[model samples]
Target: MAFELPPPLAELRTRVRAFVDDAVIPAEKAILEEDREKKRDTLNALRERTRAEGLFVPHLPKEHGGLGLGIMGMCALFREMGRSPVGAACFNCDAPDQGNMDLLLKAAAPAVRERWLAPLARGEITSGFAMTEPAPGAGADPSNLKTRATKVDGGWLIDGHKWYTTGGGDASFLIVMARTSDDPRTGATMFVVDRQADGVEHVRDVPVMSPPILQHREAELRFNSVRIGDDAVLGGVGEGFRLAQARLVPARLTHCMRWLGWADRALHMCREYVLTRESFGKTLAHHQMIQKKIADAVSGIHAGNLMTIHCASMLEQGLDKEARPYSSMAKNHVARLLCQILDDAIQMHGSLGYSEDMPFSLWYRFARSARIADGPDEVHDVVVARDFLRGALTTLV
Candidate 1:
């Protein structure tokens, strides 16, 4: 299919690209510290500017104070925002929160929407999705979830140890998944636990190679007898896995959209470096090895972009139920491509690419997690393969 954005969306993409280049990119150098408060302040300021510029929360519905762009529109705009690592946050479309907002909008009760969704859409507060847990608990397998929510007098009492909860430290609230019954398939439920709720402890942020922004900071959390009102349930009881799957499918696609933009940026930087940096008395661009890397990176990104657009279009048509296999394929393919593209970009730039002076290194670190985040490549690969083997695969073309 020939993919073309509507004129308005195309214009929005251009504006977002300009904003990232002019504002977000420049701020990266100024805010290079691990200080959580400083990072939050800088990003919050940019988010306000983004809101003033009419580009905040592009993925949300218009009634919720966002552009209400559909999935395809988001694909067009998110790529532009992905150019800067901080781009998504500035627009209030960064993950955990972005995915969290989508979940709340779909499943939250009327009162819950008034209190949480409104502020979240307005970029007033961020959120975390607490699904993945430490070992001996849920990791890639949700059936192993060790967290439990027992019925109590006025609420559910939750007890669990979760790690790798993205944005846990700064999150205003968390959408926590816990088991409520013995049936593995229909036993889990999702709860909206306040960050400051009793027994909801924020353990130390887990160290990783990536930057320490609120969005990327994975944290360990301990929910020891935390109590939340029955109204805190996100959807119906025993529906955590179903709701989480619904949220994650689109969330994974958005990650691909943003990462594609970052990969494109890396390629652009590599091209510029090759044009001017000479080796053996000739520009590196003239060398076959360098040319090969450039060509491969460009082609890989193009393929990934098409896959992302296809998946986005599928989602726009409300084909999410049928698009699962395609989503998995796109997510796995694009994530691996992103890592390869950045690695090649670094190779072309030599020591400069490896150094923190350039954005490539930082992007490289961030992209490394893409392979494991959301759902790992191995799991997605199996999803695709299993569907194909069962003759259940739909035509992605």
Candidate 2:
């Protein structure tokens, strides 16, 4: 199936690209070293401006004060938002909030929607997804989950330790995955735990190799008898893994889309540099070596974008199960390409690209994490291999 954006979505994409280039990218320069509170304030101000421009929450339903764009539309728009490190946040569409919003919209009950999803969609608060845990617990395999949710008289008591919980420090709440039964296939359940709850403790932000603004601020969470009502269970008792997979597939592809934009921008910077910079009595652009890097980067980016849109189309057509293999392939392929493109750009610029004077260094550091986040390359490789063995190789064809 053709994945071309319709005329309206094409227009929206252009508008978002212009806004990101003119507003978001310029604002990002000022907030690179801003304090946490100041960062929040600056992003909030940008969100207001984005709303005024009628581009806020463009992926959510129109009933939720968004533009009601589907997955295909999001694929196009998110790439523009990725042009700036903070572009997605400025438009109220950054993760883990963006992924959380998608989950709540599909899984939350009416009351839960009113209490949590409404504010999230409006960008009134931030949220986190807590699934990964320390060793001896769940990491790549959810079946090994160690977090427990024991039923009590009133509701449930959740006790566990989760590391790499993205945005946990500043989130108003977290969607926590806890084991509630003995069945490995259906033991885990998702609970909505408030950040201010008595038993919820934030240990520290795990250090990562990424730009300060782009770093996910991975939090170590300790849930000690965190009490919550029956209302907190999301998508019912045994659907944690199922629901998480739903969130992850799209989340992975969106990451690809945004990183694609960042890589594209880096390539553009490299092209400009090569054309203007002289080397050995000739412009760098005239060098065959430099031209090869540019050509490869462009070709890789085109392939990555195609894979991203193909995955988006699968999700849009309600084929999440069928899309898993493609999702893994795209995530692994595009994430690697993102790093390679940034590396090429840095190499072409020599010392300047490696320095803080340019954004290539920052983009390189951030793109490195894309390979590990939302499932690492190794895991995705296993997924692709397994799918091939099962004869679900149509996606590859």
Candidate 3:
């Protein structure tokens, strides 16, 4: 089905696009110049401007002092923000933090929200999701979670070694996943660990391919004897797996939305370059090979966008009774297509494309990481295929 943007969303898209062209894009060079160190300084400036423009935190409700935009409107704004890699972050709508905010809003206690969510919402402090761990711990296979959180007097003792915890080093609080029960079926549980809590130690930050926007610092957290009250439990005990799934499904789709914006930008850069940059006795756009690449990139992005909107529309209308299958399909397909599009855009740009001089390399790096970060494509493929075969085989019988 062809999905259409509602009127409010359309206007939101236009406003975000203008914001990207004016405020966000101009700051990209400065960010790249100083790399990770530059983001704090740049964001300090952007935050003031975004707040003045009323473009900050569109997904958040106005009760919390945000724009109070819903799913559809936020999707449109996110796509425009994706146009500039720094766009959403500048507006305080970027991931890890955005996803963290959604979790706290959905499940955190009022006191918890006041403690963790408020500063994050106002862009005062950063947070991280400490779900991914090393080999034996929580990795691609969450079922292999090795962290242990035992009941203790007045609280729970959390002892786990979590790695690749995005935004970990700088996070004020970490939503940690640990195995709380020996019951094979319902063993996993989630606990909130404050950074200042005892036994919560930040290991070295793992360097990643992309620049650190909103401080995407992957760190190893050693929870020796960290403790928190029963209130620390998010959702409920033994519901960690279920809650994590719910948070991740929506989050994966949102990532797809943001990456679609990046893919769109990469294609636009290629289009502009091909039209002006001279090739073998002609402009690159005039060459059949270059034209085909552009066509494919456009088609890939369009298809990816449609699939994303389908899931998002259902989410908005509360029609997504169960969106696991569709969410899986959208996340996997968009990541695959985006990686392909960004690769082609880089190739079309030639050596310059591969160079840090262009954003294509950055886009490509992000595309590659997206495939593994949320869940590997192979894992999603298994999910889709298993469901499809079950339905099809039952029909055949």
Model 3 per-residue lDDT at 375? 88
Instruction: State the C-alpha lDDT per candidate.
Output: 0.87, 0.87, 0.81
The candidates, ranked best first by TM-score, are 2, 1, 3
| Candidate 3 clashes between residue pairs 3 or more apart in a chain or in different chains | none
Better of 2 and 3 by TM-score: 2
Clashes in predicted model 2: 0
Ranking by lDDT: 1, 2, 3
The residue-by-residue lDDT of candidate 3 on 314-377, one tens digit each, is 6777755356767788898888878888888779888988897777777677568788888898
Deviating ranges (above 4 Å) for candidate 2: 35-38, 395-397
Writing each residue's lDDT as its tens digit, candidate 2 over 1-397 gives: 7766688888888899998888888888665656344456667787888899899998889888899988888889999899777888888888899999888888886777788988888888888889999999988777889999999987999999999988898889999999999897889999888889999999988888873453277889999989998988899999998998989999998998888888888888888889999999999999999989999999999998998888888898898899999999999988998899888888998999889898888878867878877887999999999998998856544
lDDT of 3: 0.81
